[model samples]
Target: MTNYDEVPYPDFIHPATHPGNMAAIARLHGVNAPPPESCRVLELACGPGGNLISLATLLPSSHFEGVDFAAGHVKTGNAMIGKLGLTNIQLHHAKIEDWVTHPESEQDRFDYIIAHGVYSWVPEEVRQSILAICQMRLSANGIALISYNTYPGWHQRQMARDMMRYHADGIEDPHKRLRHGKALLSSVAQNVPQGSAYRVALEEELKALDQANEAYISHEQFEDTNRPCYFHEFAAEAGAQCLQVIAEADWGDSTYEQVRPDVASALASLPKIRRGQTLDFFRRRTFRQTLVCHESVAVSEQLQSADMASMHFVTSSSLQGDQITGSNGLSGTVEDPTTRQAMECLVAEYPASMSYQELCEVVETEEPRSLATLQTDLFNLVCVGLVSVSASPTEVRREVSSHPRALPLAREQVLRGDTVTNLRHQPIRLDDTTAHLIRCCDGETDHAGLVERMVAYSMANGGLVEGDQVVTGEESLRVLVTAKMTSNLQRLAAMALLVG
Candidate 1:
């Protein structure tokens, strides 16, 4: 096995794997899943427990367990769990093959089993063991999320991986291997003949590699085993284990908005697994986070309106006129009057999620509509990626407090680096100024005290300055720091990084 202690993969939360989101997806498909508020969650290959710990902070009532082969990862994750004073989550140092051997592992079936980065990266035996665990250890109605690299898209990435590994595999140092591998790929991309098909694919792969972190490149590209399978093949294998893929974890990406209506109509006629495979072939999907359940479980892709009664809605999108502009800058027009108003309400709630009933009440107050009608409209918006649904509400402060307290997990993260996990289990990269501001939030510092601390820190560093002019006077520096502090605090609040 490759030692991850040498070049540790950066651990971060994946919101799609959150039990709340998974439960919502389950409900959308008519699966009677365990509630996210009290669900038992297990994560395989959970590095340092970043994702599990973040979930623990949010859902204190739920229990989380993570299993990893690496001792260093387990040690680091256990240390964080201790510091956070959380009793509901535990990180264990154990291989996946050995995990099922434990008596407790077999006894306590998890409501959610997550294998985020494990499927495509491991050998066939390990992969089979993962599926077996999911089959035997998952709750009767549980949803196990397994993410993997798929074919078509992986076909291109495989070529790039082979070239990089061929050039850099002999290197002993992991970091050097990553550097040389990337350099080799870059050189090929630059030297390849213009307008050739290979050049086009290589350049696209290089573009993706450029966005990836060194840890990702090291583990994903340079690892000994990476087996990308077709969606149908994966589905068939899961079926062999008595598991069925219900749907993709990301509902929006699974929609037919990208394909033509005729293609979608043709796909809709096919069986569920075949439809998914055909869709993947059309989109050339490189990766998938699939939600699987017991083969006997009755699954329905047609979402019921009643399910929304227990759900909440949230989005970082802005309602500009009739168009809802996503956080990523993609815009979708909401033509229906009621849905447009509902979108307005969702946008106003930004980081804080509003319960489905609460949003419907507010929207109905302005524009009357049946609950079923409203839910259908909202589901459409969800499929379009303009909004998202959650089975449990995300607890976050919409208003900045007099003495803002950052989440303990976030405070711990800031000490390590600029990237901190928010209340939503999403990672937010902070600027130096914002990171400094977060470090000062301890619920004891008053607004004025915070400003004074920022002013002093700024002066000691290099003094507060306006573009060209360095402000030396105490009053001017205080005023500038105050404004900057206020903006930073508001930004943190909007990011759901603040607790109280």
Candidate 2:
């Protein structure tokens, strides 16, 4: 009915939805979460199983199960799983409410329960059933990640949604409805007064909608049901189901720095739910990815450095003078000398994670400091979101091997589409040339062989070109291909695509 079979939701991996990262956050909050390496994971409404499949490939020992109402999505995902020859994961075509009847659901409990992008989009009954499943199927100390839209940030988006629905009223075709809705919004955004606050908000929404794919726009803007609620209300609902809100998946979102000092102090004086609600009001958060656990589990309110000793740290941030500039456009300053040295170690190990003990050993070689000081500095970095902490290190190779082999999932994805998931559970778009190059990296082809295959591929597809001009000589073309191969290999390794 929603045109999901026609244009399925884009296959993607949400980094925050990764169980290892969730476990890290859980442990930071003093929950003895099950280890992600060998834990059982379940995903509700896991359309095409993109996120779960990636996790299964990365952690071979772990078992994964997904339930989706769409038969096409389940078929596509299971086909990919079969192609990959993975024995650890399966995607079932079943409704979320009926998942309790599934054999996997009846036999074992899941350590991590993920229900991303389903809460606000589904009906009230389905939403309650999702929470009920989390309570029934979750193991003791297991964490459940549930993402949904929040207010009052959505208030502006709601106005835009009303406009879109008004313009596309009575349109039975989903694609037609989406197109007309976007056109009306675009016209309004351009004609509105330039300096008005409403105009700015409209323009922002328009920009985001324009960049999204058709499937995303169809579900997000034109869905029949898009209910958003306050954080406190959502917490109350979860509490009624014997679950408690532990922490936000994105650590920085819940921090006090989002608002002014006085506002934060006022918020701190309120009850926990009231504090979260008031903070959301101050920050105007549009969406939330919240982690919940059994109500009996003791969640620590204060974070200590010792909590991080068992974790691994990863970052794609560079040391620019005293600032740590992350690839995600967020930056933080490293004023302390010891912290600066520690950041350098992390920068050198981008695309690969370093264990706490390994980082301590490396950082202390030149700048010896108290272990407590180092842990405290790293903890501050985590709070600021410059560095990501995970329960286990991602096994992505940083260096380019002579016979480089990408993960089978990425290699398979490159053949099917322009996007592939990296070891970090993030998508990377591949160009035609890069895709051709990656197809040749089967762990049996050397650098010279890769260049030869790429040259042949380019010549067969479209003649080789240097800069804006086509190359004339075979020797020059080979040389160009060699240079391109070297650069692309390093780039691929940096993107965490190369596994060997």
Candidate 3:
């Protein structure tokens, strides 16, 4: 076993691990899932509790627990929890084999169990143990999210991994090993011809590796116990433990819209699980975040718009004129006037979600549309990644406090650095101005006090300067500061960072 004491995985949020998403997907598939707001979540091999802690901060009513073999991770994560004053989550230092033997582990049942980045990195025995834990410890309607490196696509990456591992063999230091590994790839990439298949693949892999964090490379590729399996193989393993495949965490990947019509037609006739396996081959999917439930739970393969009635819909994508085009260009154009109007209404109440019925009522007066058409449009939006559906509605605090408050976790993170997890469990990158604005929202200052503090801070920090001249006049500075503060506060609220 590789001890993560020396090189720990980065503390980060994985959207797939969010209970709200898992529960929503389960419900979409016809499973009666637990409510995310009050669920009990257990994560195996949760490094430093980064993902779980973020969830704990956002959903204060929910309970979270994490178990990892790394004592260093446990200690550091516990300290962070203490600093944040979160009593709903905890971290434990214990190996899977040992942890499974505990009385509490046997007695307690979790509504959501997450094993991200663990299954493919461990031995078969450990993998089986994880599945057994999920089968034994999961609540009746609970879902377990397991992320792993999948096959067909991983075959290409493995060729590169083999070369890197061989080149770095006997190198004691991780940093030195990483340097040598990159050098080897660079040499090969430069020596190969420009258009050969091998050269193209090698260069593409090298570019990806260069962009990834050193810690990720050290543990993910160079780790000794990496075992990539086919989708059927993984499903078989889960089946043996009495868990059935529900659906994938990323809903978009499950569709065949990206493939040729002929290929998709052939795949459509296959069985549900077999269709997934075939799609993986055609898509060359290298990784997956799979969600599974107990064997007894019947999962619906077809998605019905009626299923979305109980769910809440949210989208950060902006509407331009009467079209709701995605920023990523993946979601094909939606130009229906009624659909555009609905999107505009949703964006106005940004971060918060309106139920399907509520949305219909709101837009019916402007352009009356059939319920089926509305549901179909919403589903299309979800497929394109322009919209997100959740089991729990957004918890918006509309009444700003005497001292307008932001999320404590986000506030602390902004003070320390420019990246912070928003209340929606998504990371928001901050510029200097935005970072300062977030740090100022401590719930201890009124609007005037905040404006005064921001003015002084901006002047001292060069934020108030336009080109070379500082806006120093009292009236000018106040107007500038107030406008900037209001804009940022609205943005923060839209991002779901503000709290009452």
Candidate 4:
């Protein structure tokens, strides 16, 4: 599974990456933390410290040291670090094996060690060396984060890879191999070998290739792009090196409820902490690369469980929404109303497992909310680890629970329902009377009928309010007779309600 990491000889884009609240992720996994100032960090294959620089900037009190096999990456990261005026960050240019194999090397222990792209891309021996570095260097209270490719997902990609590799095999030059892969994928079938699984993939890949720009093709077909791994196989490989699965990077999509497709159900009993369906657990349509923590922790001292200890684990992001829905049904902060609606859908779906790509699909192909809105909702979910996250193949650690009771929004009366589910998981917004009125809003109820109900109720009370005593207006909610008659027809239509 450690097939693709640690292989970038001298190529990497140097975009500044954002950092999640690692202190919080550790708390969810039952790990403790000292203050940022007291923490020591290490990042294996720190790509220009894009994310690490962000992390350092956010947690200035923390100390960081990074190693990348690519010397140029190290040089670039150092340049950024210098520009950022980072006092506590350091970098090294050397392979994991070279560093660990040094006999008299200083034992480099860390509080929180993260390696994103190196583990899966590197060769097996190098991967083992990286794990050894963790085992030998990770402090007691320290946690090591390693990311790699996963199964089930990789299984499908293997189909595409098989076709690519098959076409690639006949060519000796790397670019030629790439051309073959691109050609077969884009070419129309000329008596395609009957029922070849690779045939369809080749066509699809070809179409995608022709449409894609040159930059993408060149990067994807790099000489080192041939490495990959499976999910369970990755876990086993990590186990061999004494690493444990902490959680997936992106969370909230799969909680325990959704992922009920026949295939997911069959894997249901596999001792999953929580389960759900996912396409890309994080980012876009890319396959997963799991993050792992060392089984043996560093930092022997007991940690202080301040506000951070109780803080929910979520990806660090600036999403836009007025309110976000927690997996537990609690509403979180958002920038707008639309964001709120999107949160409701994520909550309603409540799958045990969801890939980042799958959630995007839900947002795009379904009701198609704004990308910013969906991201904000996901960010809130990530903060709490309710939707744990990983850009690579990852696992869900938190349990998924159903919303208490989804009550429909109506007008004039309140109706309690058991449970309603859908991908368009919007919230039950309207209040009791309003909700009931909405349900009955067929443009049929007359003001007379409204008055009759009021009068009948008044008669039962032995008295009735006169027209003078009652005020009615659009803004005044009491004008239920008219307001409930036609408030959210358009919105309901958008929700695809069958009501007339």
Candidate 5:
């Protein structure tokens, strides 16, 4: 089995912030003031606390207890809980299967059991043990989420893994292994035809990755246990305990698009088997964090899709602050341009939020239904960071940056440079001319003083300032500074990075 035991788990972004979880939660339970404070969420192999912490932040009342054998990760998570001041979460430095199944244990049955990144990592015995615990500890109507590496998708990844293994065989150093793997791929490009499907796809993926910033890539690839799963196989394993798939994380992604049209169509044609097969087919699924439930309880014959867009948005693992629509959060048909446009507008103002009522108004839909109409739009808006949910009307915030990923890398650049001193991670990428403009944010510098400095900087450079500046005149310059400063402030507030 390739001995993945030694591989360190990927340093994944916490699941609380995971789009998959956010999407799944929205699907499982709406912002609909959950069932009860007594409901317990049990997570297995909850590495380093990102997922649990994020969920804790979202639902302050729920009791979340997670277990992992990786003590170091538990310690790191404990530190984050202290930093974040989350009170409802508890971390245990033991494997969950051991803890739950141990004799003399006093803990009650759990209402929700989430085991993401588990089934594929541990050996089959450990997985079965975990399943047995879920069956024993889960309450009626309880949900036990067990995410594994699904098949079809696993095929491509294994091909990539084969390449990696072939390139780095017998290489003990992790750095050397990584470099060797990447270098070997680069080497093969020279011999391969440029336009071939594999060649073209690999090149484009590499280029897109190169364009991605350091934090983004590090968060993505440099993990310990990034493995794949087989769909039907994992479901069959879970079924041992009467646990079944209720839905997937980013549930809509589990829709027609991720699956082949014919496959989806064929599944749609069948009844229980097709539904069960679709639930089982996580093989092709790249990253899954599903929401599972008891075989008898949560699967209702009602067949009500509460809100796909909203559920997907909050559960989505993507932190780009992009908006989503339909199925997951609030439901709407994208075939309707008003619905699409409404979602675009909401996402267009991320970190800054839009009211459900206001969104419907913007889409030009009629009154009463407008609120209902905007529901899905707002749900989708949650995915991309275009909108945030908050308590009060005045507390809402917004940002106008077109390229969000560039912001972090750009802020680092601004901080390192001597010209933009006393600034600590603000600008969403300021050009040299605009760089001079952002210093005005310190509150000491007035708008006129900023404009004068911007002009002086522009004059020094040839028509454009340093690092891809455009010469559209002072009016444009003022607009750029004002717009970015406003956007940065809003984003900072959303992240609690700013005061006042």
Candidate 6:
């Protein structure tokens, strides 16, 4: 096992791991669980604490504690917490086994436990320990999220991992190992004759690896312990620990509509758990983020419209005339007048969420529709990844301050040139101008001040229109700067970057 201190995993947010999202899914399945607003959260193997930090910032009432063996990650994460002035979250440098023995006193049990990227890559003892922590330390009606590599899907990826590991053996330096691994893959991908299945597989694997970060390759593929198991086997292990899987972190995977009709019919014959296992085989799923609760907790296998109606819905889609299109690569057009009207209303309040009842009221159909129909429409939108359902309502600060206050975590990330993770847990890559504008949103400048600073920064850094027509008049430049600032602020609000 490689010490993560050498090559730490990149700090990123996983929305599926968010307690609100997880709890919402659990509730939809008829499991009584704690609300995310003020729950206790525990994260195993929290590297640099980016995911937890994002959650803590958004849900200030919730308390978060992270435990990791790597001291460097803990230190860096703690430093970030201090800089952000957030006291609700803390990171400790300790092994999972050690932490379980002497848990924090503020909360004896956590409402949610997250172990992302830790289950399939650790030793058997460590894996069992993680489950034990969830079983023993999880609060009554708590939900635990564990993500791992699944077999059939990982069966192909394993071959690639083995090849990379074999080529990088005896390499001590992480960077050198990564370089050697890439070169080895490239050599094999190029030498294999065309039209060969082996060549095709290698090329496909290479293409996927090309987009991954070096640290990911080093720790994920090159790590000593990488175990991929069948979905049933994982479920059995959880059952042994007195835990039962309630749902997958991804809602689409849990629904059969996403699968072909014939395949779905075939899977319908098996028991629910077995059906999931068989579906894995059909889909060749490589990874899974499974959500579990104590076996004593009763959970419904089916989702109800009432459950969805109780939740709030949000989407980043744009409506042009009667058509609603998603920016997140969600396919299909929404043209039904009722659905279209609801979607348009949601889009108008971008980055904010509307309750199902509110949506119905706003649409005010002449031929009043049942809650079931609205629920189905919203679920369809969610299935296409165009919309998200949340247990809590979104809090947006529409009033731009004298110096508008952006999210503190986002401000820090922008200054450090890292991708900004929004409240939705989606990463946004900002250009130089946008990044500067975000940094300026520290709540010190009013609208005029912001425009003035943006103009000065733009003029000093070679005005807004570069390599194109230049605005000669000072008055025109200021007006252009003001309009640009307003548009940028609106865009930021849409991106969920503004904080109340």
Model 1 stretches with alpha carbons more than 4 Å out: 101-107, 365-369, 463-476
Question: lDDT for every model?
Answer: 0.85, 0.86, 0.83, 0.48, 0.51, 0.84
Candidate 5 per-residue C-alpha lDDT over 129-201 given as tens digits, one digit per residue, 9 for 90 to 100 = 8788777787665656666666665565555556656777777765566667667666675568878878864
TM-score of candidate 1 versus the correct structure, residues matched by position: 0.95
Which portions of model 5 miss their true places by more than 4 Å? Answer: 1-10, 14-39, 102-107, 193-227, 258-266, 272-284, 298-484, 493-500
Give me the displacement of residue 268 in model 4, in angstroms.
Answer: 7.1
Between prediction 4 and prediction 6, which has the larger lDDT? 6
- The model with the greater TM-score, 1 or 2, is 1
Looking at model 6, residue 360 earns an lDDT score of 83
User: How would the candidate models be sorted by lDDT, starting from the highest?
Assistant: 2, 1, 6, 3, 5, 4
lDDT of 2 by residue, 384-406 (tens): 77888999887778889989998
Judged by lDDT against the true structure, how good is candidate 4? Answer: 0.48
Model 4 worst lDDT window (10 residues):
400-409
Model 2, position 106, has a per-residue lDDT of 39
TM-score of 4: 0.51
Global local distance difference test of model 3: 0.83
Candidate 4 lDDT, tens digit per residue, 336-422? 455445444545433323444555454444444565555555554554544444222211212211211111212211233311111
Cα-based TM-score, every candidate:
0.95, 0.94, 0.91, 0.51, 0.62, 0.91
User: Which predicted model would earn the best TM-score?
Assistant: 1
Superposed on all Cα atoms, the candidates' RMSDs to the truth, in angstroms, are 2.1, 2.4, 3.1, 19.7, 8.8, 2.9
True-vs-predicted CA distance for residue 19, candidate 3, Å = 1.4
Q: Which ten residues in a row have the lowest lDDT in candidate 2?
A: 99-108
User: What is the lDDT, from 0 to 100, of the residue 27 in candidate 2?
Assistant: 91
